[model samples]
Every structure is written in C-alpha cells, then in structure tokens.
Target: MGGERVGRGRGTPLRAVAYAAGGVVLLAGCASMPDSGDLRGVESTPRQDTQVRVFAMPPSEDASSAQIVQGFLEALTSDDPDYKTARQYLTPEAAKTWRPELSTTVLSDVPDAQPDRPDQDDTGSLTYTLTGTKVATVDAQQAYAPASGAYNKLVHLTKRTKSGEWRIDEVPQGVVMGKSDFQRNYMSVDKYYFASNTPGAGEGFLPTAVADPVYVRSHVDPTTRMVRSLIGGPTNWLKPAVRSSFPPGTALREDTGALTPDDRGRLTVPLNDEAAEVGTARCEEMAAQLLLTLRTLSPAVEEAELRTGDRQLCTLSQKGADDVAGRGALHRPGYLYFVDDEHRLVRIAAGGSDSQPDPVPGALGEGEKALRSVAVARDERTAAGVSLDGGSLYVGSLAPGGALGEPVLRSRGKTEEDRLTAPSWDAQGGLWVADRDPGEPGLYLLAEGAEEPLRVRTPDLDGRVRAVRVAADGVRIALVVEKGDRRSLLVGRIDRSPADGGTDEGQAVTVVGLRSATPELEQVTAMSWAGDSRLVVVGREQGGVEQMRYVAVDGSTPDVPPPAALTGVKAVTASEDERAPLVAYSVDGIVRLPSGAQWQKVTEGTAPVYPG
Candidate 1:
C-alpha cells in the first residue's frame, strides 16, 4: 500500500499481474495485432505443471519515486540468489553497500509506504516512511526470534539529472516482508551439534545431538547453505551448550558447488585445510554431524563422506553415525506408561498392536502409594512419580523387585494445586520439578536423580510456574507460568556450575534467558517436547476454542499440520522420537493417535508419559 501521490509524472501506468493455475499472466492495455506478419507455428518444451518460479519485474524507465520503493520491496520476496534484481532499484552506492543478509524483519502484513513532502533544498530528493507491525526476525546467523511492537523505517530516493531515473539511495539494513512472504521464501532447518560439558557424557559414551534451528532460503541451494551454516558453528544463543566437531575455520572447499545426494543417497562434503588434519575418530564425528543435519532436509541422505582436496578424511554410514551420536529419529520408547484407574503405574508396548496393559515391575506399580503423575528416565531404568496428594516426589528403579525409597524431594505447599508439578528427566539423569507454593514458589532439580535437590534460580521469572519439562539435551527447559487465570509457555536456557565452598555447596543451576514460546496462547493447559526443537502444545488463542499444534522454540508454528482434534485434553505426552504415537488424556480416557489415523481410546488412565 502506498500513500497519496502528488502526480503521475512521466512514468507509465502500472500494469497488474494475476496468478493463474498454470502460470502468471500479465494484464496489459489493449494493443493492435500485426496482420501482415508471417504466421509460423512456434514449438515449445512442455514443463511440469507443478514446477513454478516467480521472478520480480525490473523497474521501468522513468519510474516515479513511489513505484521505485514498491518495486524494491517486492523484489526482496523473490527467489533470486544474492538479490541481484533488488539492487537494481537502488543507487550505485546503496546497491554496493546494502546487505540483505544482515537480518530479516518480518511484519504482520505488507508494509505501508507513505511519501513525505518534497525537500525544499533538494527538489530531486524525496523520502518514504515504511511502517508495519513487527512479527519476528531472522538474524545473520539465521536464528529466528519472536519480535513485537511497531516497525518504522525510512527509505530515501533521488532522481538522476542525466537519465531522469529514480532509484533508492538510502534503505533499511535488511529486507522486510510480511509473514506470508517469509513463509514462502524461507524454511526452517535444524543444525546438529554435540552437547558440551554434560556430566558423564565423555569418551566411549554416545554424544547427544543438540538441535539449533535456523532459517535458510527455500529456493537457493539449501543443502549447500545448510552445510555451510553447520560448519560455521552453532548460533550464539546455543554456542555455550553445544560444540561443533569441525575444527575452527573449517569451511566448504572453495571449488565445491551445489551439494546433492548421489544415486546411492551418499553426500560427499569437501572441506578446507582446517579439517584435513583431524584424526580418524574426530573426522567420523564431524561426518556424523553432517549426516544428522542433512537428514533433516533430505531423508534420502543415508551416508556422508568427508573429503579434503583429493584425499578422503572419513566416511560414515547412517548406522555408523547413529553409533557416534544418538539416533533421535529412529528411537522409540519401550512403552507408553500411564497412571491406570487404580492409580498405579502401568504400561503397554509402545509399538505393539495387541499388547495388554500391565503394571510396571517397580514399587510404584504395586499401588502402595496412589500416584498423580510420572516421568521415566531416558534409559527407562528409573522412574519418578508425585504422590496423589502431590506433596511428595519419589524415585524408583524400573527393574523387577525394585523397592520404593523415601521421597527424594517434598513440597511444603499446603494444597494439592500448590504442590509439586509433574517431574521431567533430562538425558543426564537429572530430574526437574517446580513448586507452586504461593509464598515460596521455586524450580528444583535433582542431579543424577539422587543428589540433594537444587533450587534453580529464575531471576527473570514473573509468575508462579505450573509445569516443567526439560529437553533431552539437558540444556533447555520449558515452563508453564501462570500469573493469574492466564498461563503462558516459556522456554529458558539451563546454566550449570559446580558449587565452590558455600553454605549450600552443590551443583548450582539457573534457568535464564526466558522467552515466550507461545505468546499467542492465552492459556497453556499441557505441553510436551515432540522433537529436538519442537513442542506439541495444547493451548487456545485469546478468546478461541481449545486446540493443539506444534510450535518451535522460537515461537513460530512449524509447517506440519496439527494433530487430530480431541475434546477436553487434560494431559499430553510425546517421545523425543517423533515417530512415536501421541498419547493424551482426554474426556474419552487415555487415547493414542497412530500415524495418519484418528485417536483410539486406550484403557482408562490419566497422565500418560513416554521416556523423556
């Protein structure tokens, strides 16, 4: 949308283009056809109807200042690499200095450009003010973050005395576009890196892959760009918790071009000299990271080979990579554990069709103490449960004849609603829970599920935490915080340190840098980590009906469709392995949603859970 124009000037009337089912059709003014021309049949090659590419039209000669601003904004949404066409609308100096890659500012809708009065001093110069409601931003590192408030910027244009052509002389640092255009031009991909400083995660133990999600151009050579981003190292937000196996300064070989998997689904990556000196073990780890990150883009990529110059550094197959780093996509929980009607922990085969429910082999399954909620360790060797009163937290072995020990942690909250929330286990065997006491609300963690509970500091928290779920990487935690009747979902980074001599000398942990993951949801009843950087949230928008959807940690909705609708969902659980079926406690009782099917009611139960 543009502001009122003073005059049409010498520019030609703007022509409208309409998108049709087959291709784009340009609507032009009436023109006379030449009857004297030779009538020859034109031959053309038929292209696939599904393949469509949209290109921005270049600026017409003698264009007005308003048309120049509009054309440049449209060009930013095109698929052109390096935005070559967009620069044509800018002055020579501005074109040379403009950096569209610096960052992308997303708006709620197309920006409104309003022209200001002509300059009294310089008649040839004019400025247009661009304003919109901000949505989010993608930084140079490609990391996405939710942004709010107003977006106001100015674009200055000048008319050339020689050609009388108008071009933008001053523009914003990065391109700005509406949310729809952003979804069409960019896509999200996760870059995998090995977890850093995780306790007991050392040599001979499988390194955990931490996901750092970023956006890349959809039509560009995305595979190559993704690889380069991975080699460039994790984003700054996640850099402290993860480490790249590639040596510093390692990059794609200068000669290498677009990357694609061969017929055998093997992708060979050529790196610079920085990676040539790595040993066989470290090289394999590097290859593993590449395979994991690429597989997210192309499931066909089954193997990856790392090369430097003419020599092969190392080659790793999908299975070999899984051996080096844990296989997140292929892992399935052993069972779908839930609280049965009798208030005992019971389970059914995770992948079995006819398996009947059976109580677990631990003391919690004996029904000695009625359970309220439960969390199983990643290894499925240990279990933690809150009592029916929700005041006591118990940890027990899942092995047969395992006895239930004294409550490892207890809450002093007086009422059930003010007691401990459901517990969550991280990959490092750490248990996380939040106390909802009105007077002394806090978040606590049990290192290795045996040490004294550590109160994790929430320096920036604004409300009482209602629930807590730690990601598998153990470096991120999600909390449902309630200030009043309204509840919001927030994800924070976990910082850990070994305590020195002090009054309470133990491992000190703090949850910092809290950011809203569901700012649109007025209330979040339940949520679960469904993937590395995705969560299945059951929440409703402001004044809307309840629904379920998958939201990324950055607060943007994923491309995947939402789960099948169900009524009165009380609790939800999903395994880090996305292939595992979704289990939830709804009005119909415990139900499971198999892939591509409707929800089917399971045995009467509540608080279903999968290994965290």
Candidate 2:
C-alpha cells in the first residue's frame, strides 16, 4: 500500500490576511460580498465576448475600508505571473514589505506555471494605501513575536493601466494573514495488498485511483493478491483504511485462533446435533477443505505452475519454503471436513491466507492433513447401487505430512446416461442427481436397496440443477437452476409412481428476480437450512460476484436480503442449527454472520467456514 502525493494542487498564499478579514466581515453581516450567485460570475466572467479578461480587476467605485483591505491582500497573494506589476498599487512601505522569497516558493512547485496576461479592461494603478508597524503576533515559524508590532503594507490591486484601462494602486497597513496546514507522509503500496478492510467480493486498489492516479486497469487476483481492505474514497480518508490497523474491532478478529491436525493424517471432529452450530472451529474446517481440494484438483498449485492464468500466459510459479506469519490475537482461519471410513470427520486443514504477505504463511494443524487427503481417482464402471459418498474418506491414506490427493468421482449406471450433473443428499438418506441430455432432463433418486434408481424426466429443465437438496419431508426435492439472465430456486415433489418412463420428477415453482442485477447469480454452489422453515442459497452472481440469499420452504419469496451494497460474496453455507450462515467473498478475508449478521472477519482468507 504505497502512495505518493499528486504534484498538482491549488495554491494558497501566506499574506491573505486582509482577505480573511473581509471574509470575517461577510460572516458577521457587516459586509455582503459574493454568494453562490456571485460565484457563478467567476465562471461566466472567463467566457465574456469582450477582449478576454486575463485576470480580475478591483471595482472602479470607491469601496469601504474593508473592501480596500481585501483588494490589497488579493493583489499581493495572487498566483498570477504578472503579480510583480502590482508594485505600483502598494504604498512605499508596503512595496518594501512585498517579499520575493514568498512569491518564488509559491510559484515554484506548480505543475505548469503560465500566469494570465493583462486584458484591455484592466483597472489602473493604486488609488488607496495603508501601513502599520510594530504589531505583536505569531510568525510563519510557529514562534510568538514580541510585543512590538512590525510595520506592514496593504496594496490596492487592479488589472488596468492608465487612460481608463482600469487600475487601483496603493498598499494599506493593518494586513491580516492566513495559511493552510496540509502535509504529506510516506504510504507504501505493499500495505494495500496485506491489510484487512472490508470483507466479501469488492474491487478496489492500493493507493486506489485517487492516491495512485497512474494505473489504467487495477484488477487483483483473489487467489494470491491478498488485499485486506480499502480506504480513502472521496468521503472517508480520516478513518483507518484497513481492518488490521490500530484499535481493531471484534467483528474482524473474533474467530482467529490456531488449530493443528491430529494423527492418522486426518482433521477429525465430532458433528454437533444442533442444526445451527456455526462455531469458529466449523468455519476453520470448511476453509481448509476448499483450499486443499483446490490444491489437489488444480495442476497449477505446484511451485512452478502458479501463473497469472491458465495455459501459460504469465507464469507465476511458487518459489521458496512455506511458513506462517505469527498467529495473532485476531486472525480468522479457514478449514474443511469430510467423513472417514468409520463415519467420522477425521481431517482438517487451513485455508489459504487472504491477506497478502511478502512470504506467505504455512498451514496450521489439520492443514497438512486436509491437503494430503485430497486425491483424484476414477472408476471405469458405473452401477445404480453406488453411493456418491461411499468412496469419499475423511482421512488420508498416509500420515498428515503426505502430499495432496486428486478428487474422486463415483456414479452408478450402465452407460454415459448414468452420468450425474447435479448431486445432493438429504438428511433422510435420499440422494438426487440431474442431467441435461437432449432427449430429456434426467432426475434420479437413489435409496438403499433400490435396484433401478427412481428416475424423473423434465425436458423443460435440460440443464437446471447445479445444486439439489432433499426437502424436510423426504417427499419433496429442491432444484436450483441457472438460466440466461435469471437464476431461480425451484422446488418439486418426489413421486414414487412411474411416470412416462421409469423416473419421477418433482413439481416445479419459479423463484424469480434472484439475479436482477449483475453480475447475475448463475450457479447455486451451496445451500443449507437457515432454520427449520428457511433456506439459504449461496451462489455465484453473474460476472463472478459471489452472494448468499434466502427463501422459505413454504413457497414464499426469500426474506434474506443481500448484504447492503456488498460486492464480493465467494461462498455461503448454513450452520448446524440453521442460525446464521458464513459467506466467503473475493475480498482478502472471510465474513461470518447469520441471515442478518453483517460481514465480520479479523484477517483475510479464501474459505473461512466448514461443517463437521
């Protein structure tokens, strides 16, 4: 997070005291100067038909003592290059008081210095002057001056020369002065990539557009950039830019504890009975699962394969050893869990850190176990009696230190028709899968001892089910579909009676307006019970904005409103008790909350929630 000051800025002079006094008079009602209406002239005055008025001139008519003083101060403090011509407007003592060093300092730093040339309508020389000496005050050095009041001069300035060209000449004493106190400091660009600010998927940059007014495109990679937060927009700069800085809040750092994996190269933990048990441990578990899964599935995880893109655009191979920055009092963690042969979740792993580090951190505890257990396997034949969860194991074959394993996909069928597009399980032991073949959309239900899987056909829904879940009654099924611009939450009933063929399809209901704004919600990646009656749908919005939303099982419109003005929502899932669900966005950190809890995270990570 490095930042440099903009070279171009408006000028403010030190001797504008007389102008300040005029402003004070206007404030007190003693004098009425320009209001918004008068300021409008400032714009129009530059566009008049007459010979272009290069600079403004003082009024021709006699002005009050205050006005005269304002004219004097403005002339001396003017940024215009012809300012030296104002010498004639000052009194003898005032001319001597006009310092050259001040003028040089003010004009030297300007990006481009071209003063306005005098115009035909310029006012003539000075017509008034004032002088005073020995006035006690504070000087520019911030030190107090003695009781003696030093002599000062005020010059009445105008744009014109002689012969009605227009001008007022003569400096007056009793000058008032004002100056600005803006300063600059060092801002490192590295900070923007590592600090934690807002969570979820959002797009902003280090030094951002304003601070680093140079870059044309500033996109960051969610996998590695590790940006924590954003700050200093037009409205807010005085506040801390990222969540990790200074007086940290609980909302950001609550679940940031460390966890290590157990023996058997597995992160085993008991599943809680309550439906809404979303604890820090659960979150850590989920995060580990996703990262480990990604590591095993993607060929690019190797030290030499981590490039900017797929198929070799700009190779970003990983280099060097692995280590974790010190675990902090406030660090949010990510993990994942799976079932072992004994029907217990035995493995856990740490999710990739969201906050960028010069040298990234290593996985803690079950982190290695999760990674080592990840493997990709393929079975040649298919059968209807197969359970998708059968081959999936919670523990790895080797110890926790072993390398990751690839994913394994299992299905039951004679041919490719037996392929499953959408697969989900209900608490009632029913598994549902969907397909989008040309003949008809296929929906299959597999239960214990059912030789021929219950099959349902819905040609209307060729490729709808990215996510499927069994309803509470075990008699109903829910299918989440993604179509053109709209993604719907669809519900149907499980029918045992064979229909046109040997399959049974659930009735369909439309959940519209789910993807009203882009990016659209194209895929339903995860969905869980928000409560006994409510459901939360976590999916990818069109253009890759991850989001979480809710709907009711009673066929009512979803009440779970999207996060207010939130941008990145990577993944969403429900807790055991169906209370709040955690959402992982593209932002550097993960945010946890119920349907109503706002985004909260301490440090940043890709996946921060898991169910065990």
lDDT of 1 by residue, 1-612 (tens): 122332222333332242434553211101111112221111011221223444566777746666677677777776677888789899999999999999999988766666686333146788878888899999999999999999999998888889888888999999998787788778899999988767645787888888889999877778899999999999988887778899999999999989998999989999999998999999999998988888768788889999999999999998888888874445678899999888999999885674368998889899978999999998889999999999999999888899998999888899999999999999889999998988889999898787889888899899999999998888888999999789999998887667653546456777888899998899999999999899999989989999998999988889898999988999999988887899899998889899999999887889999987
TM-score of 1: 0.91
- Per lDDT, the best of the predicted structures is 1
Instruction: Give residue 383's lDDT in candidate 1 (0 to 100).
Output: 92
**Cα RMSD for candidate 1?**
6.1
Runs of candidate 1 exceeding 4 Å displacement = 1-51, 118-122, 354-356, 501-506
Q: Cα miss at 45, model 1 (Å)?
A: 26
What is the TM-score of each predicted model, taking all chains together?
0.91, 0.28
Model 1 — which ten-residue stretch has the worst lDDT? 26-35
